[model samples]
Target: MSTAEDREELLADVGDRIRAERHARGWTQAQLGTRCGLSAKVVAHVENGQTSLPLYYLAELCCGLGVTMSALLSDAWVMPTRQREERALTPRQAHILRVAASTGLPLSQVAARVGTTRQVVAARLSESYRLLGVSHLPQDERRAAAARIAEERGLFDAIESYAA
Candidate 1:
Protein backbone atom coordinates (compact mmCIF):
# COMPACT_ATOMS: atom_id res chain seq x y z
CA MET A 1 0.00 0.00 0.00
CA SER A 2 1.01 3.61 -0.45
CA THR A 3 2.16 5.61 2.59
CA ALA A 4 -1.14 7.47 2.63
CA GLU A 5 -3.08 4.23 2.54
CA ASP A 6 -0.93 2.76 5.31
CA ARG A 7 -1.50 5.81 7.48
CA GLU A 8 -5.24 5.65 6.90
CA GLU A 9 -5.26 1.95 7.78
CA LEU A 10 -3.41 2.62 11.03
CA LEU A 11 -5.81 5.36 11.94
CA ALA A 12 -8.74 3.07 11.26
CA ASP A 13 -7.32 0.32 13.40
CA VAL A 14 -6.66 2.71 16.26
CA GLY A 15 -10.15 4.11 15.91
CA ASP A 16 -11.64 0.62 16.09
CA ARG A 17 -9.74 -0.08 19.27
CA ILE A 18 -10.91 3.17 20.79
CA ARG A 19 -14.50 2.46 19.88
CA ALA A 20 -14.27 -1.03 21.32
CA GLU A 21 -12.94 0.29 24.60
CA ARG A 22 -15.65 2.92 24.80
CA HIS A 23 -18.33 0.34 24.06
CA ALA A 24 -16.95 -2.04 26.63
CA ARG A 25 -17.29 0.70 29.20
CA GLY A 26 -20.81 1.50 27.95
CA TRP A 27 -20.02 5.16 27.52
CA THR A 28 -21.32 7.48 24.87
CA GLN A 29 -18.93 9.51 22.78
CA ALA A 30 -20.07 12.65 24.56
CA GLN A 31 -19.40 11.13 27.98
CA LEU A 32 -15.92 10.01 26.95
CA GLY A 33 -15.32 13.43 25.44
CA THR A 34 -16.42 15.09 28.66
CA ARG A 35 -14.00 13.00 30.67
CA CYS A 36 -11.18 13.81 28.23
CA GLY A 37 -12.15 17.50 27.87
CA LEU A 38 -12.97 17.13 24.20
CA SER A 39 -16.16 17.52 22.25
CA ALA A 40 -18.25 14.60 21.05
CA LYS A 41 -17.62 15.77 17.52
CA VAL A 42 -13.93 15.33 18.02
CA VAL A 43 -14.39 11.85 19.42
CA ALA A 44 -16.67 10.93 16.57
CA HIS A 45 -14.20 12.18 14.04
CA VAL A 46 -11.43 10.20 15.62
CA GLU A 47 -13.52 7.04 15.86
CA ASN A 48 -14.61 7.39 12.27
CA GLY A 49 -11.02 7.92 11.16
CA GLN A 50 -12.11 11.09 9.47
CA THR A 51 -9.22 13.09 10.88
CA SER A 52 -5.84 12.71 12.52
CA LEU A 53 -5.58 13.73 16.17
CA PRO A 54 -2.64 15.28 17.95
CA LEU A 55 -0.77 13.05 20.37
CA TYR A 56 -1.94 15.19 23.25
CA TYR A 57 -5.61 14.60 22.45
CA LEU A 58 -4.94 10.93 21.93
CA ALA A 59 -3.31 10.75 25.34
CA GLU A 60 -6.28 12.50 26.86
CA LEU A 61 -8.57 9.95 25.30
CA CYS A 62 -6.51 7.13 26.74
CA CYS A 63 -6.70 8.71 30.18
CA GLY A 64 -10.41 9.22 29.82
CA LEU A 65 -10.80 5.63 28.71
CA GLY A 66 -8.54 4.45 31.54
CA VAL A 67 -6.15 2.69 29.14
CA THR A 68 -2.47 3.18 28.54
CA MET A 69 -1.17 4.79 25.36
CA SER A 70 0.72 1.62 24.54
CA ALA A 71 -2.36 -0.52 25.09
CA LEU A 72 -4.42 1.67 22.86
CA LEU A 73 -1.83 1.48 20.10
CA SER A 74 -0.99 -2.21 20.43
CA ASP A 75 -2.58 -4.78 18.12
CA ALA A 76 -2.27 -7.50 20.73
CA TRP A 77 -4.23 -5.68 23.42
CA VAL A 78 -7.57 -7.07 24.51
CA MET A 79 -10.13 -5.79 26.97
CA PRO A 80 -9.75 -7.62 30.23
CA THR A 81 -12.73 -9.00 32.12
CA ARG A 82 -13.60 -7.03 35.23
CA GLN A 83 -13.96 -8.75 38.54
CA ARG A 84 -16.87 -8.27 40.93
CA GLU A 85 -14.70 -6.29 43.28
CA GLU A 86 -13.98 -3.77 40.61
CA ARG A 87 -17.59 -2.67 40.67
CA ALA A 88 -17.77 -2.53 44.44
CA LEU A 89 -17.06 1.16 44.47
CA THR A 90 -20.17 3.32 44.24
CA PRO A 91 -20.33 5.95 41.58
CA ARG A 92 -19.69 8.70 44.10
CA GLN A 93 -16.69 6.93 45.51
CA ALA A 94 -15.37 6.25 42.02
CA HIS A 95 -15.84 9.86 41.01
CA ILE A 96 -14.11 11.21 44.07
CA LEU A 97 -11.33 8.70 43.75
CA ARG A 98 -10.94 9.40 40.09
CA VAL A 99 -10.69 13.15 40.55
CA ALA A 100 -8.34 12.83 43.48
CA ALA A 101 -6.10 10.38 41.70
CA SER A 102 -5.99 12.05 38.32
CA THR A 103 -6.15 15.75 39.04
CA GLY A 104 -3.29 16.19 41.53
CA LEU A 105 -5.52 18.77 43.21
CA PRO A 106 -5.40 19.62 46.88
CA LEU A 107 -8.01 18.15 49.17
CA SER A 108 -9.77 21.46 49.46
CA GLN A 109 -9.95 21.86 45.70
CA VAL A 110 -11.08 18.30 45.25
CA ALA A 111 -13.79 18.75 47.86
CA ALA A 112 -14.96 21.92 46.20
CA ARG A 113 -15.14 20.25 42.83
CA VAL A 114 -16.99 17.26 44.24
CA GLY A 115 -19.37 19.56 46.13
CA THR A 116 -18.41 18.37 49.57
CA THR A 117 -16.29 19.53 52.45
CA ARG A 118 -12.63 18.63 52.74
CA GLN A 119 -13.43 16.37 55.65
CA VAL A 120 -15.94 14.45 53.58
CA VAL A 121 -13.50 14.10 50.73
CA ALA A 122 -10.90 12.76 53.13
CA ALA A 123 -13.39 10.39 54.66
CA ARG A 124 -14.51 9.10 51.29
CA LEU A 125 -10.93 8.69 50.20
CA SER A 126 -10.19 6.72 53.32
CA GLU A 127 -13.19 4.56 52.65
CA SER A 128 -12.01 4.04 49.11
CA TYR A 129 -8.54 3.10 50.25
CA ARG A 130 -10.02 0.52 52.57
CA LEU A 131 -12.30 -0.85 49.93
CA LEU A 132 -9.47 -1.12 47.47
CA GLY A 133 -7.46 -2.92 50.18
CA VAL A 134 -4.79 -0.27 50.29
CA SER A 135 -5.53 0.99 53.77
CA HIS A 136 -2.66 -1.05 55.13
CA LEU A 137 -0.21 1.14 53.28
CA PRO A 138 1.11 4.31 54.77
CA GLN A 139 -1.46 7.09 54.54
CA ASP A 140 0.66 8.99 52.03
CA GLU A 141 0.82 6.05 49.65
CA ARG A 142 -2.80 5.00 49.86
CA ARG A 143 -4.16 7.32 47.22
CA ALA A 144 -1.59 6.46 44.60
CA ALA A 145 -1.88 2.78 45.34
CA ALA A 146 -5.65 2.87 45.12
CA ALA A 147 -5.43 4.84 41.89
CA ARG A 148 -3.14 2.30 40.35
CA ILE A 149 -5.39 -0.56 41.35
CA ALA A 150 -8.47 1.22 40.15
CA GLU A 151 -6.93 2.00 36.79
CA GLU A 152 -5.76 -1.57 36.35
CA ARG A 153 -9.21 -2.92 37.09
CA GLY A 154 -10.92 -0.39 34.85
CA LEU A 155 -12.67 1.27 37.76
CA PHE A 156 -12.13 4.63 36.12
CA ASP A 157 -13.73 3.47 32.88
CA ALA A 158 -17.46 4.04 32.85
CA ILE A 159 -18.29 6.71 35.35
CA GLU A 160 -21.98 6.21 36.06
CA SER A 161 -24.21 9.25 35.90
CA TYR A 162 -24.29 11.02 39.21
CA ALA A 163 -24.83 14.56 40.40
CA ALA A 164 -21.38 15.90 41.21
Candidate 2:
Protein backbone atom coordinates (compact mmCIF):
# COMPACT_ATOMS: atom_id res chain seq x y z
CA MET A 1 0.00 0.00 0.00
CA SER A 2 1.07 3.67 0.21
CA THR A 3 4.81 3.85 0.53
CA ALA A 4 6.76 5.06 3.59
CA GLU A 5 5.02 2.48 5.74
CA ASP A 6 5.81 -0.72 7.61
CA ARG A 7 4.40 -4.20 7.12
CA GLU A 8 1.64 -3.62 9.64
CA GLU A 9 0.29 -0.76 7.59
CA LEU A 10 0.33 -2.93 4.54
CA LEU A 11 -1.73 -5.53 6.33
CA ALA A 12 -4.20 -2.97 7.62
CA ASP A 13 -4.63 -1.55 4.16
CA VAL A 14 -5.65 -4.93 2.88
CA GLY A 15 -8.03 -5.23 5.78
CA ASP A 16 -9.45 -1.82 5.03
CA ARG A 17 -10.01 -2.81 1.45
CA ILE A 18 -11.96 -5.83 2.53
CA ARG A 19 -14.02 -3.70 4.90
CA ALA A 20 -14.64 -1.16 2.18
CA GLU A 21 -15.95 -3.82 -0.15
CA ARG A 22 -18.20 -5.16 2.56
CA HIS A 23 -19.67 -1.74 3.22
CA ALA A 24 -20.10 -1.16 -0.47
CA ARG A 25 -22.33 -4.19 -0.66
CA GLY A 26 -24.32 -2.99 2.38
CA TRP A 27 -23.39 -6.17 4.14
CA THR A 28 -22.67 -6.33 7.84
CA GLN A 29 -19.69 -8.27 9.08
CA ALA A 30 -22.04 -11.00 10.26
CA GLN A 31 -23.81 -11.25 6.93
CA LEU A 32 -20.55 -11.48 5.14
CA GLY A 33 -19.44 -14.00 7.70
CA THR A 34 -22.40 -16.16 6.81
CA ARG A 35 -21.50 -15.95 3.16
CA CYS A 36 -17.97 -16.98 4.01
CA GLY A 37 -19.00 -19.48 6.73
CA LEU A 38 -16.74 -17.79 9.25
CA SER A 39 -17.44 -16.05 12.47
CA ALA A 40 -17.37 -12.28 12.51
CA LYS A 41 -14.26 -12.25 14.70
CA VAL A 42 -12.18 -13.95 12.02
CA VAL A 43 -13.41 -11.49 9.41
CA ALA A 44 -12.28 -8.70 11.70
CA HIS A 45 -8.82 -10.23 11.97
CA VAL A 46 -8.26 -10.68 8.24
CA GLU A 47 -9.49 -7.19 7.58
CA ASN A 48 -6.83 -6.22 10.07
CA GLY A 49 -4.30 -8.56 8.44
CA GLN A 50 -3.16 -9.77 11.82
CA THR A 51 -2.73 -13.20 10.26
CA SER A 52 -1.11 -14.38 7.10
CA LEU A 53 -3.90 -15.60 4.90
CA PRO A 54 -3.30 -18.98 3.43
CA LEU A 55 -2.92 -18.46 -0.31
CA TYR A 56 -5.83 -20.79 -1.02
CA TYR A 57 -8.17 -18.74 1.15
CA LEU A 58 -6.76 -15.55 -0.23
CA ALA A 59 -7.84 -16.62 -3.70
CA GLU A 60 -11.24 -17.58 -2.41
CA LEU A 61 -11.69 -14.30 -0.60
CA CYS A 62 -10.71 -12.42 -3.72
CA CYS A 63 -13.44 -14.18 -5.68
CA GLY A 64 -16.04 -13.67 -2.98
CA LEU A 65 -15.31 -9.97 -2.71
CA GLY A 66 -15.79 -9.56 -6.44
CA VAL A 67 -12.20 -8.52 -6.77
CA THR A 68 -9.42 -9.97 -8.83
CA MET A 69 -6.74 -12.06 -7.19
CA SER A 70 -4.21 -9.47 -8.22
CA ALA A 71 -5.96 -7.03 -5.92
CA LEU A 72 -4.47 -8.87 -2.99
CA LEU A 73 -0.99 -9.13 -4.51
CA SER A 74 0.05 -5.52 -4.54
CA ASP A 75 2.68 -4.31 -2.08
CA ALA A 76 -0.29 -3.57 0.12
CA TRP A 77 -0.08 -7.12 1.38
CA VAL A 78 2.86 -9.10 2.71
CA MET A 79 3.20 -12.56 4.11
CA PRO A 80 4.71 -12.65 7.56
CA THR A 81 8.40 -12.32 6.74
CA ARG A 82 9.84 -14.59 9.37
CA GLN A 83 8.36 -17.68 7.82
CA ARG A 84 7.70 -19.00 4.33
CA GLU A 85 11.16 -18.47 2.94
CA GLU A 86 11.84 -19.31 -0.72
CA ARG A 87 13.61 -22.61 -0.08
CA ALA A 88 11.43 -24.08 2.66
CA LEU A 89 9.34 -26.73 0.93
CA THR A 90 9.76 -29.81 -1.20
CA PRO A 91 8.34 -29.77 -4.71
CA ARG A 92 5.47 -32.01 -3.68
CA GLN A 93 4.48 -29.77 -0.77
CA ALA A 94 4.57 -26.72 -2.94
CA HIS A 95 2.50 -28.39 -5.62
CA ILE A 96 -0.10 -29.54 -3.15
CA LEU A 97 -0.36 -26.06 -1.74
CA ARG A 98 -0.71 -24.60 -5.19
CA VAL A 99 -3.45 -27.03 -6.02
CA ALA A 100 -5.27 -26.15 -2.84
CA ALA A 101 -4.97 -22.46 -3.53
CA SER A 102 -6.12 -22.72 -7.11
CA THR A 103 -8.86 -25.22 -6.55
CA GLY A 104 -11.06 -22.95 -4.38
CA LEU A 105 -12.26 -25.88 -2.36
CA PRO A 106 -12.75 -25.61 1.38
CA LEU A 107 -10.56 -27.98 3.32
CA SER A 108 -13.20 -30.61 3.85
CA GLN A 109 -14.60 -30.36 0.35
CA VAL A 110 -11.13 -30.60 -1.01
CA ALA A 111 -10.58 -33.72 0.99
CA ALA A 112 -13.91 -35.21 -0.01
CA ARG A 113 -13.40 -34.49 -3.67
CA VAL A 114 -10.13 -36.34 -3.50
CA GLY A 115 -11.79 -39.21 -1.65
CA THR A 116 -9.92 -38.50 1.52
CA THR A 117 -10.74 -37.24 4.98
CA ARG A 118 -10.43 -33.87 6.69
CA GLN A 119 -7.57 -35.29 8.72
CA VAL A 120 -5.70 -35.73 5.46
CA VAL A 121 -6.29 -32.13 4.60
CA ALA A 122 -5.21 -31.06 8.05
CA ALA A 123 -2.06 -33.11 7.66
CA ARG A 124 -1.32 -31.33 4.43
CA LEU A 125 -1.80 -27.95 6.05
CA SER A 126 0.44 -28.98 8.91
CA GLU A 127 3.01 -29.98 6.34
CA SER A 128 2.50 -26.56 4.84
CA TYR A 129 3.19 -25.03 8.24
CA ARG A 130 6.50 -26.86 8.34
CA LEU A 131 7.29 -25.94 4.78
CA LEU A 132 6.51 -22.35 5.59
CA GLY A 133 8.68 -22.64 8.69
CA VAL A 134 5.77 -21.99 10.98
CA SER A 135 4.82 -24.05 13.99
CA HIS A 136 2.24 -26.73 13.80
CA LEU A 137 -1.23 -25.26 13.31
CA PRO A 138 -4.27 -26.77 14.85
CA GLN A 139 -7.02 -27.63 12.42
CA ASP A 140 -9.29 -24.74 13.39
CA GLU A 141 -6.49 -22.22 13.52
CA ARG A 142 -5.02 -23.24 10.19
CA ARG A 143 -5.36 -20.41 7.71
CA ALA A 144 -6.44 -22.47 4.73
CA ALA A 145 -10.05 -23.29 5.47
CA ALA A 146 -11.80 -21.65 2.53
CA ALA A 147 -15.28 -21.19 3.93
CA ARG A 148 -14.04 -20.19 7.35
CA ILE A 149 -11.60 -17.62 6.05
CA ALA A 150 -14.09 -16.20 3.59
CA GLU A 151 -16.69 -15.68 6.27
CA GLU A 152 -14.18 -14.04 8.57
CA ARG A 153 -12.98 -11.56 5.96
CA GLY A 154 -16.29 -10.77 4.32
CA LEU A 155 -14.56 -11.98 1.19
CA PHE A 156 -17.10 -11.63 -1.59
CA ASP A 157 -14.47 -12.40 -4.17
CA ALA A 158 -13.97 -16.10 -3.54
CA ILE A 159 -14.28 -18.29 -6.66
CA GLU A 160 -17.91 -19.28 -5.98
CA SER A 161 -17.11 -22.79 -7.08
CA TYR A 162 -19.80 -24.30 -4.91
CA ALA A 163 -22.50 -22.72 -7.04
CA ALA A 164 -20.97 -24.29 -10.07
Candidate 3:
Protein backbone atom coordinates (compact mmCIF):
# COMPACT_ATOMS: atom_id res chain seq x y z
CA MET A 1 0.00 0.00 0.00
CA SER A 2 1.16 3.53 -0.72
CA THR A 3 1.39 6.22 1.91
CA ALA A 4 -0.87 9.27 1.73
CA GLU A 5 1.92 11.38 0.26
CA ASP A 6 2.57 8.74 -2.33
CA ARG A 7 -1.11 8.60 -3.22
CA GLU A 8 -1.25 12.36 -3.58
CA GLU A 9 1.72 12.36 -5.89
CA LEU A 10 0.19 9.58 -7.93
CA LEU A 11 -3.06 11.49 -8.24
CA ALA A 12 -1.23 14.61 -9.29
CA ASP A 13 0.87 12.83 -11.88
CA VAL A 14 -2.18 11.08 -13.30
CA GLY A 15 -3.85 14.44 -13.63
CA ASP A 16 -0.86 15.87 -15.46
CA ARG A 17 -0.54 12.93 -17.82
CA ILE A 18 -4.22 12.83 -18.69
CA ARG A 19 -4.53 16.55 -19.15
CA ALA A 20 -1.46 16.59 -21.36
CA GLU A 21 -2.95 13.89 -23.51
CA ARG A 22 -6.27 15.68 -23.66
CA HIS A 23 -4.62 18.89 -24.68
CA ALA A 24 -2.57 17.07 -27.30
CA ARG A 25 -5.86 16.12 -28.92
CA GLY A 26 -6.66 19.84 -29.06
CA TRP A 27 -9.50 19.35 -26.61
CA THR A 28 -10.10 22.11 -24.14
CA GLN A 29 -10.82 21.61 -20.49
CA ALA A 30 -14.48 22.21 -21.14
CA GLN A 31 -14.55 19.53 -23.79
CA LEU A 32 -12.79 17.01 -21.57
CA GLY A 33 -14.98 18.00 -18.67
CA THR A 34 -18.05 17.20 -20.70
CA ARG A 35 -16.58 13.92 -21.75
CA CYS A 36 -15.93 13.06 -18.13
CA GLY A 37 -19.20 14.53 -16.93
CA LEU A 38 -17.19 17.01 -14.92
CA SER A 39 -17.35 20.77 -14.88
CA ALA A 40 -14.59 22.60 -16.70
CA LYS A 41 -13.35 23.86 -13.35
CA VAL A 42 -12.99 20.30 -12.16
CA VAL A 43 -11.15 19.43 -15.32
CA ALA A 44 -8.92 22.42 -14.79
CA HIS A 45 -8.27 21.38 -11.24
CA VAL A 46 -7.35 17.90 -12.31
CA GLU A 47 -5.15 19.13 -15.09
CA ASN A 48 -3.56 21.55 -12.70
CA GLY A 49 -2.51 18.55 -10.64
CA GLN A 50 -5.43 18.40 -8.27
CA THR A 51 -7.31 15.09 -8.38
CA SER A 52 -9.07 14.41 -5.14
CA LEU A 53 -12.20 12.70 -6.25
CA PRO A 54 -13.73 9.40 -5.40
CA LEU A 55 -13.08 6.25 -7.43
CA TYR A 56 -15.89 7.18 -9.79
CA TYR A 57 -13.91 10.19 -10.97
CA LEU A 58 -11.09 7.84 -11.81
CA ALA A 59 -13.49 5.83 -13.89
CA GLU A 60 -14.71 8.94 -15.64
CA LEU A 61 -11.19 10.13 -16.31
CA CYS A 62 -10.23 6.79 -17.78
CA CYS A 63 -13.30 6.78 -19.99
CA GLY A 64 -12.55 10.25 -21.20
CA LEU A 65 -8.91 9.38 -21.93
CA GLY A 66 -9.74 6.11 -23.72
CA VAL A 67 -7.63 4.20 -21.27
CA THR A 68 -8.35 1.84 -18.41
CA MET A 69 -8.29 2.42 -14.70
CA SER A 70 -5.50 -0.09 -14.43
CA ALA A 71 -3.34 1.80 -16.90
CA LEU A 72 -4.03 5.07 -15.20
CA LEU A 73 -3.19 3.54 -11.87
CA SER A 74 -0.15 1.87 -13.25
CA ASP A 75 3.26 3.20 -12.24
CA ALA A 76 3.72 4.80 -15.62
CA TRP A 77 1.17 7.47 -14.80
CA VAL A 78 1.39 7.31 -11.06
CA MET A 79 3.75 9.77 -9.43
CA PRO A 80 6.77 8.33 -7.78
CA THR A 81 7.16 8.14 -4.07
CA ARG A 82 9.58 10.59 -2.48
CA GLN A 83 11.97 7.80 -1.76
CA ARG A 84 12.02 6.96 -5.41
CA GLU A 85 14.99 8.46 -7.22
CA GLU A 86 13.38 8.33 -10.65
CA ARG A 87 13.24 11.60 -12.55
CA ALA A 88 12.09 12.77 -15.94
CA LEU A 89 14.75 12.89 -18.58
CA THR A 90 16.49 16.13 -19.47
CA PRO A 91 14.76 18.57 -21.81
CA ARG A 92 16.53 17.28 -24.91
CA GLN A 93 15.70 13.72 -24.01
CA ALA A 94 12.14 14.59 -23.13
CA HIS A 95 11.66 16.42 -26.40
CA ILE A 96 13.06 13.49 -28.25
CA LEU A 97 10.76 11.15 -26.41
CA ARG A 98 7.62 13.20 -27.04
CA VAL A 99 8.33 13.38 -30.76
CA ALA A 100 9.14 9.71 -30.84
CA ALA A 101 6.07 8.80 -28.89
CA SER A 102 3.75 11.14 -30.73
CA THR A 103 5.00 10.55 -34.24
CA GLY A 104 7.68 7.87 -34.01
CA LEU A 105 9.79 10.07 -36.16
CA PRO A 106 13.01 8.47 -37.24
CA LEU A 107 16.07 9.29 -35.19
CA SER A 108 17.43 11.38 -38.01
CA GLN A 109 14.17 13.33 -38.17
CA VAL A 110 14.12 13.83 -34.44
CA ALA A 111 17.67 15.05 -34.55
CA ALA A 112 16.78 17.47 -37.32
CA ARG A 113 13.82 18.83 -35.41
CA VAL A 114 15.77 19.20 -32.19
CA GLY A 115 18.95 20.48 -33.86
CA THR A 116 20.93 17.62 -32.43
CA THR A 117 22.84 14.63 -33.74
CA ARG A 118 21.32 11.25 -34.44
CA GLN A 119 23.67 9.72 -31.90
CA VAL A 120 22.26 11.95 -29.19
CA VAL A 121 18.74 10.96 -30.11
CA ALA A 122 19.80 7.34 -30.22
CA ALA A 123 21.25 7.55 -26.74
CA ARG A 124 18.06 9.06 -25.37
CA LEU A 125 15.94 6.41 -27.03
CA SER A 126 18.26 3.76 -25.66
CA GLU A 127 17.43 4.92 -22.17
CA SER A 128 13.75 4.48 -22.89
CA TYR A 129 14.52 0.99 -24.17
CA ARG A 130 16.21 0.11 -20.88
CA LEU A 131 13.25 1.39 -18.96
CA LEU A 132 10.55 -0.07 -21.21
CA GLY A 133 12.68 -3.20 -21.86
CA VAL A 134 12.22 -2.97 -25.60
CA SER A 135 13.01 -0.56 -28.35
CA HIS A 136 10.29 2.07 -28.36
CA LEU A 137 7.57 1.37 -30.88
CA PRO A 138 6.26 3.60 -33.60
CA GLN A 139 2.96 5.29 -32.87
CA ASP A 140 1.11 2.57 -34.78
CA GLU A 141 2.72 -0.30 -32.88
CA ARG A 142 1.91 1.29 -29.58
CA ARG A 143 -1.67 1.75 -30.68
CA ALA A 144 -1.88 -1.88 -31.68
CA ALA A 145 -0.56 -2.97 -28.29
CA ALA A 146 -2.90 -0.63 -26.49
CA ALA A 147 -5.82 -1.99 -28.48
CA ARG A 148 -5.03 -5.48 -27.29
CA ILE A 149 -5.60 -4.20 -23.79
CA ALA A 150 -8.54 -2.02 -24.84
CA GLU A 151 -6.36 1.04 -24.72
CA GLU A 152 -5.12 3.71 -27.21
CA ARG A 153 -8.57 4.64 -28.43
CA GLY A 154 -7.22 7.55 -30.54
CA LEU A 155 -4.90 10.53 -31.04
CA PHE A 156 -4.41 13.59 -28.89
CA ASP A 157 -3.31 16.05 -31.56
CA ALA A 158 -4.37 19.04 -29.52
CA ILE A 159 -1.45 20.12 -27.35
CA GLU A 160 1.35 18.58 -29.29
CA SER A 161 3.85 21.01 -30.75
CA TYR A 162 7.43 20.30 -31.55
CA ALA A 163 8.92 20.66 -28.10
CA ALA A 164 11.05 23.54 -29.24
lDDT top scorer:
1
Of the two candidates 1 and 2, the one with more favorable TM-score, higher being better, is 1
Report residue 32 deviation for candidate 1 (angstroms): 0.1
In terms of TM-score, which candidate is strongest? 1
- Total clashing pairs for each candidate: 0, 14, 9
- Give the per-residue lDDT of model 1 (tens digit) for 83-109: 334446777888899889888799999
RMSD of 3: 14.4
Candidate 3, 96-164: lDDT as tens digits: 666666566787997888788999878876764443333456644642332222212122222245352
Error of 2 at 161 (Å): 38
Q: Which rank order by TM-score, best down to worst?
A: 1, 3, 2
lDDT: worst 10-residue window of model 3? 147-156
Q: After superposition, how far is residue 142 of candidate 1 from its true place, in Å?
A: 42
Model 2 stretches with alpha carbons more than 4 Å out: 1-5, 72-164
Give the candidate order by descending lDDT.
1, 3, 2
Model 1: per-residue Cα lDDT at residue 163: 44
Clashing residue pairs in candidate 1 are none
Each model's RMSD to truth, in Å?
A: 14.0, 18.6, 14.4
Model 1: residues with Cα > 4 Å off, grouped in runs: 79-164
Q: Which ten residues in a row have the lowest lDDT in candidate 1?
A: 79-88
How far is 125's C-alpha from truth in model 3 (Å)?
40
**Against the hidden reference, what TM-scores do the models get?**
0.49, 0.38, 0.42
